[model samples]
Each structure stands twice: as C-alpha cells, then as structure tokens.
Target: MRPISTDLDQALALLQAGELVGIPTETVYGLAADASRPDAVAKIFAMKGRPADHPVIVHIAGRQQLADWAQDIPDAAWKLADAFWPGSLTLILRRKPHVPDAVTGGQDTVGLRAPAHPLTHALLERFGGGLAAPSANQFGHVSPTTAGHVYNEFGDALGLILDGGPCTVGVESTIVGLTDAHPTLLRPGGIPAEAIEAVLGVKLIHHEKPTTAKLRVSGLLDSHYAPRTPLLVGPLAALEAEAYQRFEAGQRVALLHHSQMLQAVCGAECHAMPLNAESYARALYATLREHDGDRFDVLLLEQPPQTAAWLAVNDRVKRAASGWLA
Candidate 1:
C-alpha cells in the first residue's frame, strides 16, 4: 500500500505507451489500458489471465464521448444514459470499427461506461478516447475494492495504482445492451433489476442464456469474482456451527457473515461485512481478501437474502464457491 500518486501525467504516459495500470471506479478497481491500441488492450487480458472470449468494458468520460466508440445508440439507451450516466451503468452498443476487435473479443458490439469516480473521470478527460478495462484482479478472483487488494493480486504487474479511497458501489456496473433497441439486461450488478424496470417502465428481458448472452460486457463468465480460500455458502446458522466446529478442530476457519452476532461468536476470527446491499457489495472483495490470508481455513459466507438486491451478490458467491461443495 504505497502512497499512490493520482498524477494523471504519469498514468496517461504509461497508457499511451501501451501499458496497463489499476484505475479506480465507483464499482471497483479496473485493470486499464488504451482501448484504441490493440497491443495495449491485449496486455490487459494477458495480465489478468482472462479468457479471450470475455470482452472488457470501455471507460468513457461522458455521454457526449459515446459517439467515438459506439455507432448505434438506441433511444432506450439515451433514457438509461440520461438517468444513470457517470455512474455504474454499461451499455452495449455497436462498435464504430475503430475500437480494436481484441478489445471487444471480436464481438460486433462493445460495452461502454462513464464511471462515477473523480480520479478516473479526470484521467479519462485528459487521456481522451476510452480504456478497455476490467476488474483489477486475476480472472475469477475476488474483485478488488481497495488499493491493497489490487496490489495483492497484481504483485508487480501494474505500473500505477490510483488510490481513490474505496469504491462506493463495490460491484460491477449494471450492464444493459440494446441490440435491436430492445434493451436487455446482460448482467445484474450495482444497480438493481427492479430499479431499471422502474426507470424504463418495463421489465428488462434477461439476455437469452443460450444465445446473445456474452456479446455484451465483461465479468459475465459462468464463474468469476472468487477468492483464494474456499467459501462454503448456506444459512448463517448452518455455516456458523460448522465454522466453530472447524475452528475447534484446529482448522483455520474464516467466517463471512452479515449478522453481527457471529462476529463475536468466533471472537477475533470472524469478520462481518456490511448488512445492506450497497455496503455489502463495497465490502465483499476486501473481506474475502482479508480472510484469504493468515489464521483462516475454509471461509463460510452467511448467505444474503434472495431479494433483488442480493441477486448479484449470490451470483458472485456461487461462482467463487463453484468447486468447493461440488
């Protein structure tokens, strides 16, 4: 956790030279590269060990700059932009042909957003164009919410780590794609599905699972946002008893729960994240990272409710615990 310099000059210099840096966003920290430069964007995939088929989102400064990257902006998209721009909403639109295919993973459409982070907005304003960036963690690892999480995952791969405190949203953007101007929800994220429906006055159709699914934004992989330590997910009561049993058996068990009761149940061994959606999303990655190391064995996440707000959290947790119980 070195005191990161928010100097735009040095950051843009590295970007211009086709290098990668860790950029902050309200949702999470992103591994950023020059979007227009194919070689630079390629480094992003290689560094993260991300699959080529998984496309990245382009970071734009504002709605006005959308023309540079996207060719077809739907009317519904305009509604979304006007309502949620400069926030955590990513729109998938037809690319303008100038954005590298490598950046879009050969998809005809590219994902674009104007992140609501001051440091990143300034960088995008000065650097120009867009940056093809994804969560600043190795593919399938827990997304970084803090600068230390980025440093832990990246090690020495990153040149600049812009410390913008902690991400406010703490999850990826709510991705909506307009293929035929029929807005589709490609991913559920920081913004809830119900909120978008309320705005559009119509429920967004989830992208057909078997087709037109991944042609939208990044982080839609079947498995992603994982942690190094194995996480056992279920009711907090079930997980709580199991954690204590494991701990008593001399196993280094880490407990991730929304309930404060379990915080003292494990004494100093248990870590409690935020109870609400916003704080929970913001604290998710860092909590995983904190428990991944030292004094922990199998991690147990006290499952959140199956409400609309918990959909994205459940998706991420299910992915992280993919191979653990199965």
Candidate 2:
C-alpha cells in the first residue's frame, strides 16, 4: 500500500505530473486529479470504476477563482459562495470554454466547491488549479471519511493519500444547480438546504427525482454510497422486528440505530449512532465502513427524521439502503 502522510508537497507534485492523489476535504476524502488534464482526470474514473459521463466536483482553493471555470455566475451563486464557500456546498453553474468535458461529464455546466480542509486548501493553493475530485471510494460505495478509509479502498492504486484525520462533515457537499434561472437543490449534503435558502433569501427548488438526461450532477444516483452488505432502513420498531427475524433464521445481523428504544440482540451486533444531525452525519460513513468490514449478513439502519436538519442524513441512509430495498 502507498504511504499515507501529511506531505502536501509530494501530493502537489504528483497531481502536477498528471497523477491521482487522495485529498482530504471537510466533507469527505476525494480521489483527486488535475481538472485541466483529461489524462489525469481519466485516471480518477478508471480507478474508481466511475462512469466516464458522471461529473466530479472541481475543488478550488477559494471562491475568487470561480469565474475562471464557470461563466455567467448568477448573483445567487455569489451570495451562497460568500456565505458557504470554504465549507460544504457545491454550485453547479455554466462551464467556461476551458473547463474540460471529462470534468463536467460532457455537460455544459460544472460542479465546483471550495472545501475547508486546511491540507487540501494548501495543496490547491500550491497546485494553482482546480482539482477534479469524487469521493475516494469505489463507484456506488460508501464514501471515505478518513485517510485510512481511502488507503483501504484504493491501496497502492493511488500515488498518495494525504492524512488529514476524519472528515468533519461525514457526507458529501450540498449540490445546487445554478445553470437555470432559479437555484435548484440537486442533492442534500453537508450543508442544510434551509441554511442555503436563508443566505439566498429565496426558496431553493428541490429536485425530487434523480438526475435525468438534461440534469447531470454528482451524487444523484439512486443506489450510491452502498456497502457490500445488504442494508435496510426503516422505523426503529420495524428494524428491531426484522433483526429478530434475521437472527432466528441463522443470520448474523448488524444494527445501527439513533434511537435508544432498541436493545442489543444476543447474536447480533448493535451500535447506537448519534441522534443529532451534525454528529450523525459525522459518524455515518465511519460506522458504515466499520460494519462493512465485519461482513455481517444484514445491516439494519434506522431511518432518520424527515426534517430539514436531517435531510442530508436521510438522503444518505436511503441511498445506502436502496440496493436491498427490492
């Protein structure tokens, strides 16, 4: 396995030479490559088994460079950037002529964000360009929230993994599309939609369905962020009952719950997840990674609340549970 460390210079050198590196971000670790180099960007898709047409978010050092990649940035985009950049929010806007199609998934618009992670921010400043990055995990799998997670996923496939500890926001960025006249919520993520709305002073249009032919953005897939183990999400009562049934059937169940109502089963592994939204988001992927490593027969996750604060958590749980729903 490639060494994981805090050497930003080594990572920058690798990226400049058209190689891929695992980068730390406040939201999650990313499999990063030079945005301007199609060859480098292609490595990201190939390494992650990601589709060539699925867009990755361009991580910039700061918002000042937004105009360099995206054109016709609306006032709403600027407002949100001012309020949330260097944080967990991504703006999908009109792509400039120079922005590569590989980065934009052959679309005319691109997703861009300025992550608040200090190491990645320093690397971006030194690299002097946008880094096209997707979550540092295999396609349709749970995202990596730590350097160790990234190393476990890619191993020696990546040139380097910048060790920046655990990601503060355990989910992906909140993606908002600004290509249209009005801002639309493409995905709920680290930043709550309600917070963005307060900054923009307008109700953001929520896109309920997955990305269609016209609308293409990251993290809009139906069955993404899944574990190899089958996962089911529902009410606490339902999950507990299902757990008992699975245990009776000679299956070893793993249960992740936010409620204290359910007690541990004799033959099953049980984890009490944080009930608060931020704490829950922070621990979400880590818990999934841990359970995934254990090779449980079934992973039962209790569904989060439907309120705005828990929207991002709910979104992740639903996606992670999608594969077993049928």
Candidate 3:
C-alpha cells in the first residue's frame, strides 16, 4: 500500500476533478468530495455504502459561506455559528435550491459546518466551495480518528489522505436543527448540548431517539459506529461475571473498564479506559478500532456514568454495543 500524502495541491486537484479525498477534521477524518458536483458527492455515498436518503454534512471555510449552501438561516443558527463555527457544531437549516437532493437526503434542510482542523480548512479555502464529507469509514462502523484509520477503511482505493495526525475531538460534530420553530439537538457530539443552549439562551429540544427523528442526520442510526466483534455494555459487576463465564468457556474476551479490575478474570485481556469524559471521548474510537476483529471473540465494556459530561460518550457507546447485560 502506498503512503498517505500530505500534499494539499494533490488533494485539491483530486477534489476538483470530482474524486474522493480523505481529509482530516478535528472531530474525525472525512471522505470529502466537491459539494456542488452531484457526481462528486455521489461518490461519497457509493464508497461508504451509505444510504441514498441519509444526509451528509457540507464543510465550509466559515459562516460567510453559509448563504451559498443554505437559505432562511435563523438568528439562533447565526448565534450558534458565532459561538461554535470553525469548531465542532453542525447546523441544519433550509437548503438553497441549488443544493443537491443527494447532499440533503431529498429534504428541504441541509447540514453545514466549518471544521476546525487547519489542514482541511486550508483545503476547503483553496478549493473555494463546500466539501460534502462524512466519516471516512464503511457505513455503520467505528469512525476513523486518524489518517491510518482512514487508510485501513479504503486502502489504495482512496488516493490521497491528508495526514493531519489523530483527531483531537475524536467524535462527530454536535448537530442542531434550526429548521423547526425551536432549535433541536439532532445529535450530541464534540460540543456539549448545554453549551449550545447557553449560547442560544434557550434549552434545546433534545431528540433522544434517532430512529424517531423526522429529519435524517449522520450518526443517529441505532446500530451505527459498531465494530465487527460483538460488544456488550453494562454494569461492571454484570460484565465481570459474563467475562469470567466467557473466559472459562475458552472464549477470547476483552474487558474494557474505566475502574480498576479488582478481581482478575484469568484468560481475559483487560484494558483500562480514561476516567474523564473528555479523554475518554478522544480515545473511544481508536480504542475500539484497535481491539476489533479476530483478536477478541467478544468485548465487554463497563458502562460509563450516566451524566451530562458523558452524554456524547454514552451515545456512541450505546449505539456501538450489540447488546446490554443485566
């Protein structure tokens, strides 16, 4: 396999020619294509095996380009953009007629954001248009947090992957829907929901269940961000019992926990996770991706605390887990 390139000129040329380039964002690496070119954007869905109706977020340089892709943007949308633009927040607003149905999932609304990663920002600036990008991984799998992760997903099939190092935020952007009368939290991510609420000066209408959400958005599916191996999430005691049973039965079990493994379950590989939410979020996907596949028959994760700080981590963990133990 050829090494991933850091050449912005090569990335720009590829994107301009309506080809897919794996670009890095602070949140995660994205499979990007020129948003204005429907043919270019369609390649994103095709490569990821993403559903045609699922919308992809268009990454712009900043809020100044908002009008180019969306229309009727509300004051609240502007406020949130002011606070979080060039960071990790995605705003859903009425789409400009020129915006392709493929990008908007045939909906009137479009998802837009200005990613904070310097390399991708420069790429977007030089490209001088929105880049329709989704997590550079196979559909419904763990998101890529580094250029290597992106390479692992699509090998030489992807020509250029701008190596921007590992993602700092390590999760998708927080998606807020402003098309409704009230600002709604479509997805919780790098930015906390409370922070957005503070900026808007109103509590966001939190949509807990992605399945029931009227408008489609990225990372909201019930079984998304999952790994090939079966993952079970539950209380530590419950997981330990199950891990012990599995180990005794000659199964390869990986025990992931934030707390110390007081009782050493023989034959199971125990891995400690970051205790704090921020560090945990940064490490989540990479950890999952590393231990996934033939190494372990099953992964038993001790559930994190149910609190606001852990909201994004909990959301991803819950979706990734195949089941829960009592």
Report the C-alpha lDDT of model 1 over 1-326, residue by residue, as the tens digit. Answer: 46366778889899989898898999999999999988898898899888887788999999888888888677777788888889999988898977788878788988889999999999999998899889999888989988888888877668788888889888889888787655788887888888888888887888624256646367766667877777788787787778778877878877677776714656226677787877787778778887886556688887777787787777677767734321
- Over 4 Å off in model 2, which ranges? 323-326
Whole-model lDDT, candidate 2?
0.89
Global Cα lDDT for candidate 1: 0.81
Name the better of 2 and 3 by TM-score: 3
State residue 138's C-alpha deviation in candidate 3, in Å. Answer: 0.4
Better of 2 and 3 by lDDT: 3
Decide which is better by TM-score, 1 or 2: 2
TM-score of each: 0.92, 0.96, 0.98
Scored against the true structure, residue 318 in model 3 reaches a CA lDDT of 92
lDDT of 2 by residue, 1-326 (tens): 45798998899889999999998999999999999999999999999999989999999988899999999989998898899989999999999998999999898999999999999999998988999999999999999999999989988877799999999999999999888877899999988888888898889889856544268888878888999888898887787788899989999899888888635766678899997999999999999999985578889888888787898888888878843321
Error of 2 at 95 (Å): 0.5
